[model samples]
Target chain A: MALKLPFLQVDVFTNTPFKGNPVAVINCMNIDESLLSDKQLQAIANWTNLSETTFLFKPTTDGCDYKLRIFTPMCELPFAGHPTIGSCKAFLQFTGQKTAKSLKQECKSGIVNLTISSEGKISFKAPRADIEEIPQDVINEYRKILQIDCVAAPKLLDVGPIWVVYLTSDAESCYNANPDFAQMAIINNKYGHGGIILAGKKPGSSQDYEMRAFVPADGVQEDPVCGSGSIALIRYLQDLHNFTETTEVNITQGGRLTRQGEIFCQIKGNADGAFSYISGGNATIVIEGSINI
Target chain B: MALKLPFLQVDVFTNTPFKGNPVAVINCMNIDESLLSDKQLQAIANWTNLSETTFLFKPTTDGCDYKLRIFTPMCELPFAGHPTIGSCKAFLQFTGQKTAKSLKQECKSGIVNLTISSEGKISFKAPRADIEEIPQDVINEYRKILQIDCVAAPKLLDVGPIWVVYLTSDAESCYNANPDFAQMAIINNKYGHGGIILAGKKPGSSQDYEMRAFVPADGVQEDPVCGSGSIALIRYLQDLHNFTETTEVNITQGGRLTRQGEIFCQIKGNADGAFSYISGGNATIVIEGSINI
Candidate 1:
């Protein structure tokens, strides 16, 4: 006999279906946690073949509305951005818990705060990122592999997932980059980096910037739309521009991949430090069904 | 407004779920074909992110039960093995057309014949393969990249998707092969081959052979269970051993990946030539639901 569990596939960072990053969310609200072992979760994630799959469980700690466990195809993740928003949206719709203005999710990384707008938009404060400069020789190798000239020196940002950030002269350059994914994977593995992020400013366009993420090390040649990559970019921009006040920008991604991923990002500078917030429209549940395991 | 369509995720080549290759099947039997354009089909395939996603429509040709369109994440395929088996099972279950012992599917490559056993096993005659010996220089390059010495000369088999077949010394060698997928992709792209297949015989085991497929060019690092590769292997075996009579063998694959994929293969040689058949158990529908498109 098989155990049937409710499942939802949600598209995050965009309201339109098939245009944003997709996450598979399994609703395990009242199911026995022991029944779903780590191996089974990993198997489900691998079966979905998505960038991320999340399991929603009843919270063990007080005050937290739910517990979230995230897994990529290869390994489990302590936290991830798109799965966070996608799972929350799926949970709200599944349980019809619409009265709450905010929710707290407990995971391996601890409690994460989420705010919901009247229009159903969701926003979460990004974990603070640690930044470091890239060496000249590695920068040269990246330039050769990607075949692009950088406008500013590249930096490494660790925001849960580490990103090698590159700033090009214009949006066209960012779109035109053709990095050798195999070489990128080797470099990423050697440096213990998550992937590479390419971004350029669009002064006259509706979106402030255009971004692309290449994560071959994680088995994804290119992410359709990335959440943590967006946060890492925000942190990189704040450091490069030396911002003093709160700043907000709209970033367009996945355009090259025939997807229109619109992401809203804000960074607030305080006496302590700067905190980044990533907000996106409500996720659209594209596939609703049940999985028997 | 979103159109809700029936969708199922089926695990092929195995009776159990999550142990074989998975295919996303959409039941579009009565829906308007014009509503789902080529772009939409490709987008849906990309969204599913599976090795293959098949759309089932009313047959356009006479004497055919249904029309099938197969698409991988990157592009549409004229024909494929696993998708053919998975889609047939899905169509039979969705429409409850189990009374028929055989069915015909019209695809881009032409009509395919599928026979169903009383116990629900599905078998299909593999496409006639064209075999050619691989050059020694290229074989040497493969040896360097894969870090394995072949016991027998490799031959390229074109059974719809071309496979570079290498016969290793033993089953353990097949399981221990660690090929450089990036380098393999480059070589495969240059040679216009689908991927590399490593196989070895097990004289005393339940299964006669063990196989592994690496298809980095198709964006899959290693296919858990490959149907065409299995067919190609059968063809190669028949040629190497000069089998004058009908031969049947059981193959075990995906063991290295922690998956138990059992494939039943048969080859019949006549004055005309040799024809191969690949059979597997009834597909297990792991995920069933509807997709709003």
Candidate 2:
């Protein structure tokens, strides 16, 4: 059946149009990859032409959950937060299906659980972090290149990957952050598995940590809300502050590009082992549509 | 003044249109970015909407040395190869500038020294390689999730910040390889950085490495003529094969989407450090016009 995809294009980090990271969400029906090929998916993805486009896969199971697929102009990703939240909201309005009240996204990463509140805000919980350490010189170069004054020094803290944790002072500091990308590539090429983390104190609280991330060398210059980076920051705060009680904090990102949003993280558990569960309030569906590839 | 840029939606990796990766290169007079705002450049990039577009910074100053900028549909990339080669070839004709036997490109990744033979085959030395080790579980899941057979254990190597390398056997096996990305995301979310590297013995090589990279996790799923990935592969083969002199190999990629072509690389140096340079045998131009944006 030809479906009318209720597509919306909203900036992922910002609430306004054209300001935030552009994300497109589509309410899809009767179309599955089984009926499609990667080329076709890629064609559609290229046409939609956003950072990412999402689809709510209605698998015909009432009591069970639905599937979602996210694609960039280049390829189809296993898991992505904005796409998930955006698609879930679109799915709710698409088939008028009983929204799971929450969704457990079975992505390439694992079971990513997202809860959509009645107020239209969506929150997602990511897997825990396992921090690691990186070289010092690589750290220094990123700081020098990113040009964001180090509110916090560089450390190897494991989020999903051992992030080269770069802590900055505040959202404003992260906003004004400038990077010599050419020079930063030198450091990025030097280190294989660590990204720079820039963060500061939380906006409303002195409880834990707030931060942003930059890995343009890895294709993303700035992430509107980096789930992976947050995982690392939460763990870093736990180690530095010597506190662990779901140390909740909001990390702002995408300020320079203007798609600013906050990530909510809780570093819970004991000293021996702690988990960093990061979330960005809830994502609103920006737009929906389907392409005839 | 706005220009009526001549653009060609040429398939890159393959000779036949739509059989390989498609790159739409525009023929326009070279200009300066200093005069254009980043937003305007981004808008120009958005208008091009190619995987990567090149703006010949200006006519060659020092004989063959050319300056250029690369932009994806979304924004400007620090460096890119397809655009690098495509734009240079187009520029040579756009300005009716004579090729002085050889070519050299000053790109975001530094200088690419090109040797354009009378055969019309252009070859250049790429940047150095920064090889990384691929994790065990990441490789295991890539096979299971993407549903492609892993010819051998995968390796994660980065030439620059943009390219992360993975290896597989045979283009046929992996070219059509598509993973249940949702599952790959589970692992990527857990691991952070890792992408697909599918390849086989070059069309006819004993010691060389070949591959098709998939990075759905980082916005682009499969990049056409990933200059960075190819550079790292050259180094990987040189170190793995214990070749003392320049290791020569051919990398074929972007065929699935009709952006097909081969990048020829040479590895020069010893075990301490080496240089990975790539050149391609391609057609220069059959384009006319400009971008109004």
Candidate 1 residue-wise lDDT, B35-137, digit = tens? 8889989988998889899999999999999999999988999888888889988998889786879989999989888888898877777755779999999
Shift of residue B170 alpha carbon in model 2, Å? 28
lDDT per residue for candidate 1 within A160-248, as digits (tens), equals 88999998888888988888988899889998988999998896763378899999988888998888888888888888887777888
Fnat for model 2?
0.00
Top model by DockQ, which number?
1
lDDT of 2 at B65: 55
Using Cα atoms, each model's DockQ against the true complex is 0.78, 0.03
Expressed as tens digits, the lDDT of each residue in A108-179 for candidate 2 is 556677776665666667654565555667666666777766655567765444467776776566656676
- lDDT minimum window of 10 residues, candidate 2 chain B: B284-293
Off by over 4 Å in 1: A205-207, A269-276, B205-207, B269-276
The DockQ-based CAPRI class assigned to model 1 is: medium
